[model samples]
Target: MVTTKRNKEFCQKVRLKSTQVFIVAGTCLITVLVTLLCIGFMTRYEVDNEVANVADVDYWKDKVASSQKIWYDKGIDELNEALRTPRGPIYPKNLRIFLIQGVDGRDLAAYRFSGKDLSNGNTNFVWDKFPHFARLKNTCSQQFPCPISSVAKSLWTGIPLDKIPEAQPDCGNLVNETETPFSVLRQAQLAGLLTGFVTTQRFTGSTGAALGNTNSNYECDERMPLGSLKSGCQDIARQLITGETGKSLNVIIGGGRQMLSSLVPKSISDPVDELLCESNDGRNLLKEWRNQKLKESKVKPIKFELVQRADELESLNASNFDFLFGVMANGDLSGNSNAPSLKLMVEKSLQVLKKKNQGYLLIVEQFIQSGMNKRKELQLLNETLTNLKREEDTLTLVLLTNAIYPKPILDMSEETETINQLSETFNEAEFQIQETLYQMPSESLLFAIGPKSSIFHGVQKETFIAHAVSHVLSKSSPKT
Candidate 1:
């Protein structure tokens, strides 16, 4: 009887232990499964956040669907046809082009630099200095009073703002390859000719953007809406680094350094700008530009320089470098002593471009406000023109894109006199301006020299300028 009791107790203990072991194993397995499920949820949440940041396709689809028909110039249809014509294969050697902007006939006459009064029905100003230059007329200003329209009209496409349909806000001033031809700078680049863009305006401004960028509604990346960015519409500054024409440029000198860098930990040498340089997209474009150049250098030896200060620009020996990029300010060049003058920029550009044997196309724009600033720019322009080598193979075009402002009080500060004595005649003279609103259309002028310049005579449509340039460029046989 005692033996039987002991065996039963032992069996009971064994059963109890077996139950505990099964419970522990099941609990452990359940815990492991729950942990794996939690990990999966966390990974899914991270992916969801990323997609949410860019917004869902349905969200963007609604935005695009709601977008109304944007208005543009009526002549765009015809201009598109003209642009669609295939470019010629020929690229002539020793054919150089210089397109200079902001040489207003009215301003020239008002300042008495032309020795003739253009306001007094005197068409003689066109023939006074350079007999070959044509005084082209821009009729788009008669309709749209904005300087923006003037640039849009004279640009590669030569089409003005919307006129046919009711004008809409935030319309016009956009370029697309489907509607317009390649810019002169792009054409020159494709032709294997050196190309440069020098401006006192922001490098991504309408004038500068027109040289290389296409289809961008905004000049900077931050200004673009998420919908626009997602739709593959790149901003102007981004295009400058990635675009075919922009990357191939031999020389680029102007302002807008902040556009190429991040907002935080501002780039070295970036000036404090009135507008914030908010590139919240987490991209450092300046670094990207450098990386691109470095990668290209691996394939072929290329000497390039990226400078920021006036002293750095001045110190550069133009012939030693194949590419030069100088961003002197955050905005349009300020009167900061650290910034190089327009004349200095032009001088350096000419020197660098002239080194190429195939020829070059240099476009220089002086977009400045204030009478004093205009005077200083004009003085520098005059000096540069006077110093030009006047090569027979070079075609120089001075286009007066008049962006009029209210006449300011002509105050002569001692600081102004320090520029040089060459501006003395222009300083003491009384400055006169036609009283008009800021956007009102004013007469524009064009001066030309070199081959085929005689063909441009009398007043012509703004579109005629692009056509004429194309014609001249096409006349040459392909480079051997």
Candidate 2:
């Protein structure tokens, strides 16, 4: 009787163990099945639907510009209305957005990182490879051939280029700026954020027009040439220096020494007009600005500092100032001697902007020329991205390769060295036009990373950026 009971108990124990083993095996099988299903779904979604080699120029231009032609026929007002209404902001993380633009549109064919070595060199190739580019394999996307004027307007105003006259051919300038994305920053500022504009050239043409009416609290760019202030759309500089705008800039840095009276080199014959065909204004804008800051310092908590070198900028005691304006270059830093690099300008801008305890909007740019300038700007941006500690908190938009530069004579001999050399001189002070009409098909590349940057994924409308930026800029801190 005892042996029979022990055998029966042992059989029960084996059966229970077998049941547990079956359950564990079934669970493992389900987990594997679910994971495979997910992988399949992700693989299908991530499949590159729109990628091809630019082997033929005619086909490529025809395909990309086809949509713009349809838009071009649409009345200018119709385009304006479309741009006025930017797409909804889909990204709302607590973030910062940096708008880095290539003033001239870029060509996609010339920027590929294929053919072994992925490096863009000073020696330009007819098809230069920009290895520094983070191939948009996952999320980064681009739009082609966005014109500079329309691009500038849409970027700041949230209007699309397809919806507006790119620029007035007669005026060679932007149409108007009745509105801007700065409205989006109103909420952000109440929460302690700052806004800034820094570029290598004078805020002239489209740049000046875009910034003309902004009420943001920070702005900077190369000073308008002495001749340009009258018509160069440089009134914003005067307004910042005099605190005449609705919102006073906290920091201003750029180059326009000729306009500063004392900084003009005496050797250049008619120094002002030699730089351009404009300028007779005798106002020392910078001195006037410093004087105003000094007067304001006595009555309020106002603190403002100005410097003219990268080292000086790096050494700034940013904590002491309510505003810091550093004009580190005399004018257009591109190929200029000892000019503060765009990267340094950006670094210092961010450093000072963060002190406001509010988020910031930073617009940085290289002169709209292609080749070495564009390549260097892109390389700097990549470095900046690599070093970012709080990428999640920042939105960086790098716009490259628009077809907006002045057309130059090309060698067209299939010689890499000749093409590269020509590219360096593409933006020569004295340039010749190869084409009568300087219009470009909408075909350059765009890149964005951070909170709302992905809102513009596919072929992004020019105005989409403004809307996305406004969405983040207008974000109030989350309620705890």
Candidate 3:
């Protein structure tokens, strides 16, 4: 009996020890798992809070939806389909179009000095020049509205009072005749490729003046004889399309309706109508262009059609004729803020230009820098570039502001963070500032994505663009 009791007690003690050991092991395992889970949740919370701080997720979601709406509403997908394929060549048998945005020079130079690869870095240099803040109020005095001459003096000459270069007498004795794109256009016309100038700004704004070479001193002055009046600019527009120059412009679409109307209308005309069409001399600029294009061309009398509505643009036949001038709005086609989108303009222009077997040159200008409209304008431009890339042989050039404003930097930072978050679960390293800072120079960016695009990666001046364009077009020249 004594032996049996001892054995039983020993067995009981062994079982108790084993149970304690098992309990300790199980407790340790549960504690470890719980600790790991807590750590994971804390990490996730930190990440979420940080992301929320950097970006307004809800706002961007809404913005993306809005952008998508705009894209769909304008038939952007259809336009992209059309531009993706190459239209048979126009002249030299090769076609190239230049899309330029006139940002100021200093801003362009700054970005040029900054390295291109820094775009991915945290520096946000490009966005710094023109900070995408709230819109600016019209601050210029009514008596001294901001003129292109004043802006050009600050941008080009760097002196408000300094005289701009005068047009050479050999180039038809035009004033303010600096070496400009107009000279290049004249050369193009001489080469017989059906040159055309299109812009959203008035037909005589800074950009318009550059293309038509109307007057140097009066870049924005629409006055006739001197400005948009009976003088050289109007003459150039008329001659290019209709006059003895014989180089009939295939396209001349823009807003200068006032320049086109006669000073005095028929007796039935309203006083306001007469005033809108009034000029120093009694002449109509729009009528002159219509008449000239409608007139038989010496080489090939091109049929001319003027479209005033978006519906008109959609209904037009693509293979109609050699010359087409589409003017959608009065002064400066409505900007993206108030006008039909750039994608609409680009698709329409392509449709019209595609008629030529001798490849055509189309210039699409978005005046984004004009008062209170930069953000909307640039957004539309970005969309245009993104969509345009769908087409082959289409080289798109985006010209930025001459200087980078500090305001856009904050938004850029926000954008960078958002992209990073979407790309990964968690990124701890702060973005490098030096690399980003390097891209802050105002130098212009020539973002080219087409044949020979590699050549445009480095720092280049504006004049180089014309040369590059000419060279590309020359490649398609008929074998002599």
Highest-lDDT candidate: 1
Query: Candidate 2, TM-score vs. the true structure?
Result: 0.55
Candidate 3 ranges beyond 4 A from true positions? 1-164, 167-182, 219-247, 262-278, 297-301, 335-339, 370-373, 389-391, 403-441
Rate residue 239 of model 1 by lDDT. Answer: 84
TM-score of 3: 0.52
Candidate 1 local accuracy as lDDT?
Answer: 0.63
Clash numbers, per candidate:
1, 24, 54
User: For each candidate, what is the lDDT?
Assistant: 0.63, 0.50, 0.47
Best by TM-score: 1
Give the range where candidate 1 is weakest over 10 consecutive residues by summed lDDT: 51-60
Give the per-residue lDDT digits (tens) of candidate 2, residues 317-348: 77566677766544455534666766677677
Q: Estimate candidate 3's alpha-carbon lDDT, on a 0 to 1 scale.
A: 0.47
Q: Is candidate 1 or candidate 2 better by TM-score?
A: 1
Q: What root-mean-square deviation over C-alphas does model 2 reach?
A: 14.3
lDDT of 1 by residue, 1-480 (tens): 999999999999999999999999999999999999998887698677542222221223334433331212223433343333223223233344334455465566555444444433433232245545565544443332334523543555445333212212232334444544477677667666788888877788776666774546466767787766665666778888888878899899998766776553334445556564445576666777778888989999998888878988898898787888888877667534467887789888887887644677788877755555555566667777777776656666777766542222234322233334435534453432112222234446777755566676887766677777766655532366
Candidate 3 residue-wise lDDT, 302-327, digit = tens: 56677755667667774575666665
RMSD of each: 28.2, 14.3, 20.6
Badly placed stretches (over 4 Å) of model 2 are: 1-151, 160-192, 214-236, 239-247, 259-273, 368-374, 401-440, 477-480
What's the TM-score of each model vs. the native? Answer: 0.64, 0.55, 0.52
